[model samples]
Target: MCGIIGYVGADGALPIVATGLKNLEYRGYDSAGIALNNGTVDVFKQSGEIDDLTLPAEHSATCGIGHTRWSTHGQPTDANAHPHTDESGDVAVVHNGIIDNYESLKSELSSHTFTSETDTEVIPHLVEEHLSDGDDLLSAVEATIERLEGSFAIAVTTSGQDGFVVARQDSPLVLGHGEDGNFVASDVTAFLEHTREVSYLEDGDVALVTGADVTVYHDGGTVDRPVQTVDWEADAAEKGGYDHYMLKEIHEQPQALRQTLSGRLDTVTGDVDLELDLPEQYLNSLEEIQVVACGTSNHAGQYAARLLEQFADVRTTVEVASEYEFRGGRDPWRTLVVAVTQSGETADTLSAMRRAASAGARTLAVTNVVGSTAAREADDVVYIRAGPEIGVAATKTFAAQVATLTMLTVYVGRQRGALSGDRASTLLENLRRLPGAIQQVLDEEDATREVAYDLIDSDGFFFVGRHLGWPVAMEGALKLKEISYINAEGFAAGELKHGTLALVTEDTPVLAVLTDGAKPDQTLNNVKEVESRGAPVIGVSSLDDTTKYLDVEFAVPDLGTLEPLVANVFLQLFAYHVADALGRSIDKPRNLAKSVTVE
Candidate 1:
């Protein structure tokens, strides 16, 4: 979850490096820096946004590397920012992702004074120290990789070397070659001004980039890195035709889910391909299944667990990633571990994958980022196919995850012979209709937007539901708090009386969900309890149910197999609309950052 940029061209390198870092600013904004060779290596770094940075007027060099950091190893500060240099100041490094074993390495480094809290600082120092011991720049980088643990996509530069040295383990890094020179970045955006043709680096791969050539290696041997064409325009990554990236992303959900469900669903076979190529014995032998995720993804996991257990007849547990590994109840080896993450950079989920791997379990990842840490680390990975969701609130990615997991449920059920042909057909049909159902709710945005306004001004908001909608309610509350910076709570409707009811007060908004048809009466009962205590009630129910016992009512498409997902999207829109009305920073909310790379 950071950005890296490197360049080698006849043009003066500092300005290109600075501009590239600015383009990567959206990915990270905490700190910015660059290292360029102007006879001697010149490094400039500062805390805060790149716009506020002041670099030397000129660094006369044709090769450079830069970084924009979202702090994980240290707090956002100048002392801990990147472009970290070695003791001799001859070698400098810029990095994205984490170095998990840095603490041990830091303790072992008695020869250098560590100036930064960043794990990235360890690289330049290690490379320089290794070079001091007589290894060339490429050999030193290779040696350092052997001693390092955890995810990293690093670019190292030295005044003496004629090229940029790059290495990757679990993080993303790409190289773009141009007639002028060669380039590197965490994504295509940083170098789109130069080229559209790029090469992707796989785990344990290294590349050496110079003005005339680009060579790749694995371990210590030469390797050919496959070059891929990036079809997305530079402006597609921009806020095209929308005021905010959040709104555009929300609007993109329909196509995103469709693409996610397309090839994976097999209508004739009534199964999902998953693309995992999981062994038949392993697929059939699973005694239990576990899904680990964080934030909105956890809600998707909850629904998947319930669906898999009910429809597939597999015992399933959905656990929050932040707390999953420490929970003492589950045997990891006997379970199929499925880790869900949108960025694929979530630290907790990655750690949980390691825990599951250590316990000898089969591991799978469902993620949106191709070649992400979670994707590359897991034993098997499912791509959600939701391209580039930039909004920190995560609308399209969440919906896409749910759709893919739904197909996975049916796939596992069909594989295990637990799902009857008729039942599988019904579920697949419903899955196909989900996009339309969601679109119907989106068409009624005016009603939900008004509801959002009413709740935005309230003192406090509470969301409650029974059964499956409980997770939806939690997600609704999370969306509100995440973007609007409001105080909100989501509780199981049945648990309202157990001390949570005390928080209900006049002017407090309570959103109650009744998608569980059988529990409408019970859900209404819970609403009555809150209404009796003077809380304002807003009911989200089926479009067919015209009757309203609450102060406000929001209708949603009522399809089986978690119909609330459609309803939940409407709630997500509500939260976003309300946050917008309040003049809140809908994309980058205060005190929050996207992709928690640290615990």
Candidate 2:
């Protein structure tokens, strides 16, 4: 995935576009570049982080486009950086996503010269060819897009043209309607400081933007797009007072949970109402529930799958979206497919949802973004309301996703008459107290930090649990590996002795999640298996007796099935403190991006 930002305004475009690139850099950071247009187009780029890029002082252009690239077509180098241009250097372009048919297009345009080893370089040449044939800038862009065969969000500017043309297909692009100017970017955060009002572009929509206006077109006809105001303040993207974005986001979990639960749950009646627009009959008709997600979101889906089966009595299955196959002769009718993604733009999950739709299954998207492609394309949507998560490793969004999915479980259970009113009320009361319970865990961070210190020098880590705790274990291991750069593995506690126990040693610490419903005795036995092998045991549980067997213990709130959710917070804190102690890049770990928009 790459980040793209374009601006047309009275203010100098270089500074604005560069600032926008900095804000959107979480999406990509391999290399950075920009194209400015005054009387001529000037392109500046380098093969490093955006902060390392240097710009010339004399190019006083009022309009430009910038890009922060996560290399896909070629290696990360100055020659492969973006803001690619044509032979005459008249047309400059920045592109996100891939151009699948670039090779064929390049073969067809043999007369044109190419400089960079990127699929994006073909775009500017194609646009220049169309312009030479007397096509307007918009028509040239449209013609060039028609020849491309993969997902792309592209912005192009010509030397003589006073404005830019942008188009999107199966990729994200948003237009900002500002009073002083107009802007376009891959994410709203790019221009959020300058404008809160934005319009989302649909697949195959092309927009022509100038300093004062933006005109959108689809299929050769003018189209009107609705503009929505964003509620996130610019400061929300910044690390308020925390040492890192991950730590700040970890501390913001309470507020994030509050936002997710506000107005959706009725405390008195214990009724769950979501923003989903589906009818009650549609919800009740579900014969099975299938959840598709990836990484941490997939773990959240696993937790929800358990709730759906236990509370709603529904036959639920959780599948990794990238591996989900729809052509395996499964019935589509009476089946509901729920796609959970924090960014709402994950490539594999989106592709899986499209397959589900093609298979005639009713689809619902649970996501954090209001206008993300998944939310727009799914039959129904439930917003996570987690706000902007800047860290590459997910913290608050994971908690919010689990809470929202729990609410969804309750909603479906109530609709299907599987949960009695009294039981539902009891569950709702516990759910309401989750925010405070999570805060209690945050208040006891010192204990987690001390555990982190003890394990900071460990060669590796082994996280093991059962049932819902299984997914929690997977999430914990993921956090440690992602942020702390530790060699970590997660397994069902029962599976440990079967194979993974062979890797256990005194220097390898085993972290056990001993929570209710996770078969504590069996897990403790597994812990003792490792302890007998001389491995240190770090236990996370509500039972004080666990302290007898554990070398170190981190206590968690005893909330039944909810215990795993709260215990996860302790793991997150441990990961953060360990990474902090190791001096690792907790927020932007190497070779990782915040969102995976490409397959």
Candidate 3:
């Protein structure tokens, strides 16, 4: 998917649209383009970043749409960049998400001269044909989407029309109500600097945005979406004195976890009071909990699965959302499917939630967003409460998600009579102290930076752990690969000798998780396997005895099964320092978007 920005207002549109595109740069893109409608449409586009894009020096266009494309239809090329126009250059369209029926539509419009190898080109041409049929730009866009099939959010503008028209279908689109102009974008962050007052657009909804106001249409009738004021400042999305957004978010984990656990826990009764609407009967009757997620969220699910089984006596399975399919043997009435996504709009997770709901299973969304598709569509919702992680590589959200799931585990455990009050109280007390523990890890950033600088020249990296540590290992490796662009892998410690041991070398470094609940003895034995091969070992350990066996050791606070999470902070800092030293784009990694809206 990509970023989209549209504006129709009294002020010049080019500046607003351009700045919006820059704000959305953290989403990751291959090319950038903008289309302005003065009397005739003027398009300026390039195959690289917005910083290098050259536009008109002077233009008075007050209505326009801009795009930062990630190259879904064609390879990154100047001709393939967005603002795809009609043959006569009458209409310009910028789109996010794929068009499934573009090939057929292109074949039907053979007489139309296409300029780009993109499904987006067909939209402007189709809108042009409708405009030729005496339809206004809004009507033309409405008709154009009716003939297409796919997940998309599109912004369209024409030479003859003053305002822009935007439509959403299985994709995210929001409108920003500003005093100077009205804005449309793939997300609220695009226009947050201009106006925090915004409204979300749902599927099958289209809106006409103008200098005066926003008029939303659903199906065929007018609708009013409530405008809410965003609580965060525009500069929250900015890196606050940190080298990169990833580093800033990593340090913010303590506060993020506190926000997630705030006012939801009672150590005395061991109860969690969340907004989840599931009945007490359903909580007790739950035989299995299937978590569907992708990427780092999937790792969070994996980590939470163990807690659920151990604390709640419930069978738990973590499935990658893209490959999720309910087994036929499980009773739908007793099954609860949890969709875990940092961005509630994750395409695969939303689709998996729908699949489970269609099969009569109860659904819950564990997301950071309030009105996200997953939050809206699921039967219940549990927010992680980690605000606005602008880094493409997730840092704070992972910690918050695991913390939230841990609270959910405690709530279910107590509800099902699986855990005693004393046991619950201890966990709650530990949870209360989690923020301070994470801060301890953050305080060791200087040493972690030293170790990272030393390991930057390693041939490869391997992160290994058992049980709870396995998921943390996976997440650590992901951070390294995502930001440092290193060749890294994570696996169960016991499985190392099976085949992975052969890949170890003197130049390679092995980071082992030797935490309390992850069976440190077995992992310690595996650490010896790498040490024998002359590989440097960096240990994230809670046990003092294991530190002697490691070449370098990072101590984590003792939190029983939660030590790996504190250890994760050290890993995040390590990844950040390495990426920073290498001069890699830590906040916006190449070829990766902050949110994957396309499957």
TM-score of 2: 0.62
Off by over 4 Å in 2: 1-237
Would you list the rank order by lDDT, best first? Answer: 2, 3, 1
Candidate 2 whole-model C-alpha lDDT, 0 to 1: 0.87
- Model 3, span 75-120: residue lDDT tens: 5678989889898887889998667678889999999988777777
Could you estimate the TM-score for every candidate?
0.61, 0.62, 0.63
lDDT of 1 by residue, 1-599 (tens): 67899998777788888989988887677788888886578888898889877788876798999988766556568877788999878898988766767878998886689888777888888898889899888889999999887668899989788878999876678889787889998878787877888988999988888888998999678998878777666755345335578887777677566656654555665766665676667767778898999999998898788789888888888888978763456565558999999888999999988888888788999987655788778888887766566788888888889888988888788878899878887788777788788888788888888878866778878988876778888989999999988888986898989988888898688888877522555777888898888888888887455254578777767677557787788778888888989999988888777789998
Query: What is the TM-score (0 to 1) of candidate 1?
Result: 0.61
Stretches off by above 4 angstroms in model 3 are: 1-237
Q: Cα RMSD to native, each candidate? A: 13.5, 15.1, 15.1
The reply for model 1, stretches above 4 Å from the true place, is 1-237, 326-333, 516-519, 543-546
Clashing pairs in 1: none
Candidate 3 weakest lDDT stretch, 10 residues: 232-241
